[model samples]
Target: MQLKPALGAIVAVSMLAIVFWQQTHLDPKAPDAEFTTLSGEQIVLRELGGQPVLITFWATDCRACIEEIPDLIALHQQFAHKGLQIIAVAMPYDIPSRVKQLSEMRKLPYTVALDIEGVHARAFGDVSLTPSSFLIDRERNVVSRVTGRFNLADWRARIAAM
Candidate 1:
């Protein structure tokens, strides 16, 4: 028995839809979500309660996002001692190994989290594009959000004024 090309395509598409539907319906957030550090230790958000946080959503494949990483590293170094925490949330994609490799290669001093289910993205407001940043105050309230490539000078100035 041979299947026609159109029928084969339809079956393949239907299977793909089912897989996407299942994955999409799953919740990505945990009330107690704990992120693993580069050294493989898990740390919960509540642990960093007293410090302001800069959360950036990015993907390994995003060129524009990759370009801002060095600046982010600079910012982290400059403000970490000032009670500021920088968290890079890696968007869900097929590049966990690559992300880890890059993080190590860059020698990132800040924490990194994997958005395996996009829960962070939705909870923080679906930052669909890469390099989106959210500035959360010490109280965990989002004070500012920026999408697309950003200027480090402007970001630092805003945080300094806060």
Candidate 2:
């Protein structure tokens, strides 16, 4: 019986470590993944040089993903004019119709892409969690990789540095 508590503690600590490890998983170069926008426009990630780009992996069914929508929308509205490109990439398993419906319902000001083929996720380091964002610098270097909900203050700092 005592072993059960110790084992449980180990699992909890391991889970926390995994989260931090995933959060720090940054790529040397921003991979070029082509995204098809909801409007049917094709956007290439690598080609978007000289611009700070945020590629966010999200899913319609994820509560955290849903909660981050407003923050992302505001961020897009604020920095988009300053050459920031925010791309919300829906996870492969998320129902496409629901994703589209949510995108329309939220009135997302930024581009929303569906990674139905899992290519986008693979390109962005096999992102398997909702609300993972890769902050790519103007030079196309992935400066930061954030997993989980975004922090407004942290976002401002990243944007200011860009």
Candidate 3:
């Protein structure tokens, strides 16, 4: 009985340590990070400087991410001329070929990049979850972040406010 309690305590302590470590290292707002395009070209976050950007972290296999693609495309078309740049950063789990196939199937019209090293996701914080999005303003400041599904109306309102 005593041994069981000791083992349980050890597990609890280990879990706590992991939580603390993740929380301490995660950055909610740090915009300047290097990104690579699906075409094997490199770009920096500042490349979108002086423009409102919507950076979406996604994966090809994620159902929610796939479902949101249409909405995202609509948003891109609706606001592209209004200084809104939608950047879809595909997670490294999905290769360039897969990304291109998916984009072609979905008819995605915005700028899409490949996070082959997942460095961009880490710079913004670990985004293992699909359909995670960050809205960054012209100054490279993260204005808002959304996990899971997001509504078009909410995004429209936020962009209008900016």
Candidate 4:
């Protein structure tokens, strides 16, 4: 009985440490992450110089990520002509085939890429959480980061301001 209590305490402490680490990982300015688009073409961050860019890291099996797709799609359509560029990068653990399939099924009106080697995640401070996102201004500076999901109204306002 005593051992069980001690183990539980240890787990709780470990969980706290993990949470702290994840918090510390937040707030990083996204680096010039390179992406290979589904069309086998490469897009470097520096190339998107004159547009507000949204780089979202997600996984096929992540419910929150999936839930945010429609909103992202709509937002892309609403803002693309106004210089908004949305890029969705699949998490390293997600199957490339599934990611492509989902992208097709949803008709994602944005660039979809597979981060099979985790380079994109590392470029954004080794983000391991699903639905993580970085919002960059026209000058290519990261202006916002969302770890789980974004509120639609708030997202639109931010993009509008960009």
Candidate 5:
């Protein structure tokens, strides 16, 4: 009976440590992967180091991803002129034609790339979930990584700070 309490306490402590580590640790460098935008424009991550970049992995069928489109567009409009670069990358399984059509329909005002070969996704820690996002600072260091929907206002403040 005493062992159960002790084990529970240990587990709680380990969980707290993990949460703390995740909250404080940031990736030293963003991937130097190359992205081929839907319009055939090539973008290299390292080349855009002197500006804040938000890279989001998404899919056409994901409702959450679709819902965040407006927030992304807003972010682009608010910060593009201020040196914020936003890239919306479609997942490997997403059809290229669908991705293109949706981008056109929604009039996404940011760089949109398709990861048909999954190379970009793999380079970014094998992101298998939709709506995963990473914020890289001007120094090319990854400052934030979120795997689900996030607060637009919070992200806005973060970018503004960068």
Candidate 6:
């Protein structure tokens, strides 16, 4: 009957609305951890709550990660002046020297940290995939976590809104 089809369509629309609401409103606190930069500088995750922060887990050997550097740099350049903090953390298996060398060679304009003992990796939800990115709001709540390559335009909009 027509009533049955209308009920099914309503149910589907309700489900979609719930999913969209969750994506836009659900926020979780980021894990607190200490990040050690290549220069031996220490950055505490929780300490950076007044500004939006972008944390990316990458490896020197990951081609996808390597390819995403320029995008990350562009993001940094676009928002760094707007109270955005960007940190790139190398995976546990990536050598510290290589991370430093690549950062220097690329002239990366953001903080580059080393997860030599996998502490950072474990803290950030045991992130094992390359190019994992998390966006934290100024209140220290994690707004989004993308496992692979994410849409650059979407990222720009999210950061710009923050």
Which tens-of-lDDT digit does each residue in 27-131 have in candidate 3?
655558777666666667787788888989999999999889888988888889988988899987887899989888777888789888788777777776677
lDDT value, candidate 5, whole model: 0.89
In the range 101-151, model 4's lDDT, one tens digit per residue, is 999998888999889899888878777877888888888778777778988
Candidate number achieving the greatest lDDT relative to the actual structure: 5
* Tens digits of lDDT, candidate 5, 1-162: 899999999998986665456445545688888999999999999899799999999999999999999999999999999999999999999999999999999999999998999998888777776788999999998888877786899999999999
lDDT of each: 0.74, 0.86, 0.80, 0.85, 0.89, 0.87
Model number with the top TM-score: 2
Candidate order, lDDT descending: 5, 6, 2, 4, 3, 1
| Model 6, span 12-77: residue lDDT tens | 898666545544544488888789998899999888878999999999899999999999999999
RMSD of each: 8.1, 2.1, 5.0, 2.9, 5.4, 8.4
lDDT of 4: 0.85
RMSD of 1: 8.1
What is the lDDT for 66 in model 2?
90
In model 5, the runs with Cα more than 4 Å from the true position are 1-26
Q: Write the per-residue lDDT of candidate 2 for residues 1-162, one digit (tens) a residue.
A: 899999999998986787676656656788877899878899988788899998899998889989998888888888999999999999999888998899889888899998889998877776787788888899998888878887877987898789
Which residue pairs in candidate 3 have backbone atoms (N, alpha carbon, C) closer than 3 angstroms, thus clashing? none
lDDT at residue 155 of model 2 (Cα atoms): 86
Pairs in steric clash, model 1: none
Where model 3 places Cα greater than 4 Å from the true spot, the runs are 1-28
When sorted by TM-score, best at the front, the candidate numbers are 2, 4, 5, 6, 3, 1
lDDT, candidate 2, residue 122? 79
lDDT of 6 at 89: 94
Per-residue lDDT, model 2, residue 115, is 85
